[model samples]
Target: MKSLGEVLIQRGPFSEIVIGNSAIVRAMLESGVKVVTSYPGSPTPEIAEAINSIPKDKNPLYFEFSTNEKVALELAFGAAVNGYTSCVFFKSVGMNVVADSFVQLSMMEIPGGMVIVTGDDPGANSSQNEQDNRHYARLSYTPIFEPKDAQEVYEMFKKAVEYSRKLRSPVVLRLTTHTAHFKQKVSFGVYEPSPTGEPLFDPNANGPYIPIAQNVPVMKRRALEKLLRWQEISENYAFLQGNGSDVGIITAGLPYLSLLDVLGESAKKVDILRLGMVYPLPRKAISEFLRKHKVVKILEELDNFIEEKVKAIAYEERIDVEIVGKTDIEDWIGEYTPEKVYSVMSKFSPELVRKVEKPVKFVRVVNRPPQLCPGCGHRPVFYVLSKLLREKDISVADIGCHTLGFLEPYKVGQILLSMGHSTGTASGLSMFNKDRKVVAFLGDSTFFHAGLPGIINAVFNKHNFTLVVMENGTTAMTGHQDHPGKAIKIRQILEAIGVKHIWEVDTYQQDKLEEILKTALETPEFNVVIAKHPCMLKFTRERRRKGIIKVPQMKVTNRCTLAGVCITKFACPSFQRADDGSIFVHEDLCIGDGSCMVVCPSGALEFEKIETGGGAK
Candidate 1:
């Protein structure tokens, strides 16, 4: 079994099974991508992970996890303008952060070509919302591609890069959660290694990259012209499939694949047009297809992007096809599945509906609520906060693993909007609600991302609220990616920002943390508390990698009176109550941090040394 890195670098006309994200990287290497930048995000982080898997010495392209999506796009844009094929990727909502520059950049020409990959979450599976980024492509006048599976993800990416270079414009490659995670056997072509030599940079080669008022009209005209050319080229583009049939199905991305899965052999009964180049609509091809079919159903996820466009084309061309988009049977929300397609297709062609064999019932599954990791660093901080804070004390939560504080026994987080909004939201709350103490929780990764501005606002305004900056040493929520905090200290930033009341304490030191919280809450000024600790999962992994086997394991002593504080209030997943009504530590789950001892009022928790086969006790 070759590692992902080994598989990625393998050359020649061989085939390997890989996920869509990995396939995109293979496509990048084959397309001779010179630079890749991204902010770690779900359904797309694996793209960066796959690139990182390749050793830095052997890696063909330059890659970096930028501070945020906007920074990531700018880095890639710089490389693209300097005559190097570049790519930047992020999740659905990340498009919002990059939109400020994205819309503007589309107006300018990219000589080296650029591909903006957006891993759209149709179900909001791991995102804040299910945004259809195809709208961004339409708004920016950029060409876009939507691949059905991992195999198409590979081929379309290569085409996208080439098309971007030919058109002298950036292209958008959109993937939903289903397509991004979908795996298939993809045949590979020979790797095209990037040419040797530094790409020459000319600031004025494209002439006036800025989009000021004087240049706006010229840039807009150029963009419109490019869009028209793309529309013409798209008419001949080999994205649509299938032949003549009165009953037709027009779809793109994952929904197309689902339609096929539902129809199976019955698909031959209807003509299917799967649009790979989704933005421009391939107006001519679509109009011709509508003319051939008496009834057409537009199957798509999230929004009626394709459906509405096809209908508009029909309306303009005066085609008499009965076009059906989102109906009462199907919704525009969530990922489309074969079952869903079957349900919708039955409305049009009941005879074509094949009986789907339902899988037999196995063991009944129980609903388990999400909770913090067994030895999470945020657990101690949240535990202490829950113990100390009054009901009137409002705690605002930012994005990260710490956001889980809103669930279960802690219930520390009252409001959460987006990443790094906690401090700003808390400021607003503090101004109006003078009687309550507003404490905003922020993670280290978020502090560098967007929290700094909020903190600065707090200091300048002298808002009376305690801001707890949980320094867990990495972006724990998004797969432990490194941030600016690895080099620069958060406390130092606070001091430089003129936050006079700053207290730094270890998160595991409950006594010190509790004392600091008490003092910070009573200060009646802008108070910043830096609770510093590395994420336990990352810390333990590093320790194991270094061959350090002996670790302190906590045990439940007989003094535990079944008071249920550890189970009810603290709720570390490690502590379990047996059927016999006795409390004990599940060694498999326990990381032996012993932070639970502080919450055990009976002094029943104690640490004991344990050694594995690798080292001495």
Candidate 2:
């Protein structure tokens, strides 16, 4: 099978092979986007991945995995200011990181135009929170396109780029998790490479680039003016219209699919207003539809953003239509599916709607919640910390795979906020709760993304806390994407930020780690312990890629007391216990990190080195 990149760049006289996410990339290429940057995130990672995989010669567009969303936006904004078509993408929560800059840029002019793709996970799938970012468009006074599928994503994204440049502002392309990941047979156009040129910033090209106090009101007025103009254009965008009927359904984004599926054949009896432009309400079109229909029902996920607008429009126009929105039948949270829509629509027409059947047998499978992978180096560190802290002390957590420490076996983190708020939150706790010990935990990728600011804030405020930098050398939670601080030691960054009393220890060195942890807790000054370990999964994959395969192995070897210490305390997935309580190693799962060897109290586990790549020595 061709990689998403290959398929995207291939001359597509071929039909129906491209996925929704790749279609965005293909559209970017067709739109002549010169620069693309993103912080790797679910539902949106494939966009950056596909771009990164394109051969340099085939498509000369510049691409990068930025340190964080803010940087990603800034880089794209910089390119856009220089008259280069640029785009930046991230998941919904990541928008919070870029929000400050995004709001500011919205008030400025971009000659080359910039497209911001925000992937919203309505179900909280693989995310800390399910944020509705359609509000962002309304907040920023920017035009937004919410594509229903891959083909729409392709067509709308192309138009978005052009619209951005034409309007001299950034355009938002809101992609929900459903649209970002769901595959469809999208008929796509061929990739057209952007014109070859060295992109440079012409300072004078776009004047008043900065957002100052003097320009704030001017920018605000201009934003409103543009929104009004775009609202008229959106009214005529073809997707906003409905069939002439007394009963109508108004929906946008992924919910539109549900509306269609639920209505099915009866859809012809009712008029439907499918909104591709979710924000800056297309008032003229919506009012006309309301004037025609006696009842208008709104179906949307997460929030009543569209519903509220529809209501206001109906009232403003004195259209005597009954506006039904956010019924109790449909949940205000989670992604909308066909079944969920049917439940809502059944309230109106029970005879027509199909009932969602509950599974008869309901065979309960093994409950396998996500855990730290087998051979994860953070396992040992977390084990020791959980032992030391117990349930008394507070361990503030940040975003990463290490956040798994909040789960069972190792209930390390008691409080978790956004990406970089851990250390800052710890600082506040340290100042108030002088008697209690405070420890802030964050991963390497998060440390770069938002952790640095918090660390600096902690130091400046003279707060007392011990910070554990889980240096796993990769963003393990969201694939093994490289972070800036991963390669360059974070200790240097900390020292420069005035955080003294820093201790670095290999995660495998349990004794040294314990000593460091004890010292950090004892010390009054702000302390940082760097538990450095390469993520075992990434290490193993790298070794395989290099064809250098010898790995350390271990066995329980009949010295087993069956105390259940390793199984219960360590919780490393590599250890498998039989029904008889006999513990053994699963060679397939073990990565030879050897951190577990130190924790085995019975000395039953013995390390055996494998001579070759494929087998045991």
lDDT score at residue 202, model 2, on the 0-100 scale:
63
Candidate 1 regions exceeding 4 Å error are: 203-205, 236-243, 328-330, 346-351, 355-358, 546-550, 608-616
TM-score of each: 0.95, 0.94
Best by TM-score: 1
Best by lDDT: 1
lDDT of 2 by residue, 1-617 (tens): 77566766876645565667778888888788888999988888888677877876687678888889999999999989888999999999989989988987767778888999999998899788888898888888888888888888888898989888898888999998889986888776776555756765665655566667886887788778878878876875536545577888888878888777777777777888888888877887788788888888887888889999889888877889899887773468778888887877787666555655555886878878779988787787888887787456888888888889889888888888788899888988888775689999988888888888888887888889999999888887777888887467788888888988899998888888888898898889788999988888887888999997757777787887887777788888778888777898888887766778777777888887666577656
How many residue pairs in model 2 have overlapping backbones? 0
Task: Give the residue spans of candidate 2 off by over 4 A.
Answer: 197-205, 238-244, 356-364, 546-552, 607-616
* Candidate 1 residue lDDT tens string, 1-617: 77898888877777999999999999999998989999888989999889999877779989998888999999999899888999999999889989989998778878889999999997788887788899998888988888989998999899899989887789999988888889999998998565655775675777567788998998899999999988886775535566566788888888877787788788887888778788887998899899998998888887888888899999999999899888773477677887777777777678887756568889889787888888888888888888788998899998888989998799999898888899899999999776788899999998998899899998999888999999989988878899999899888899999999999998889899999998998898989999988899888888999997557778988888889898998898888889898998887788888788888889999987565588646
Q: Clashes per prediction?
A: 0, 0
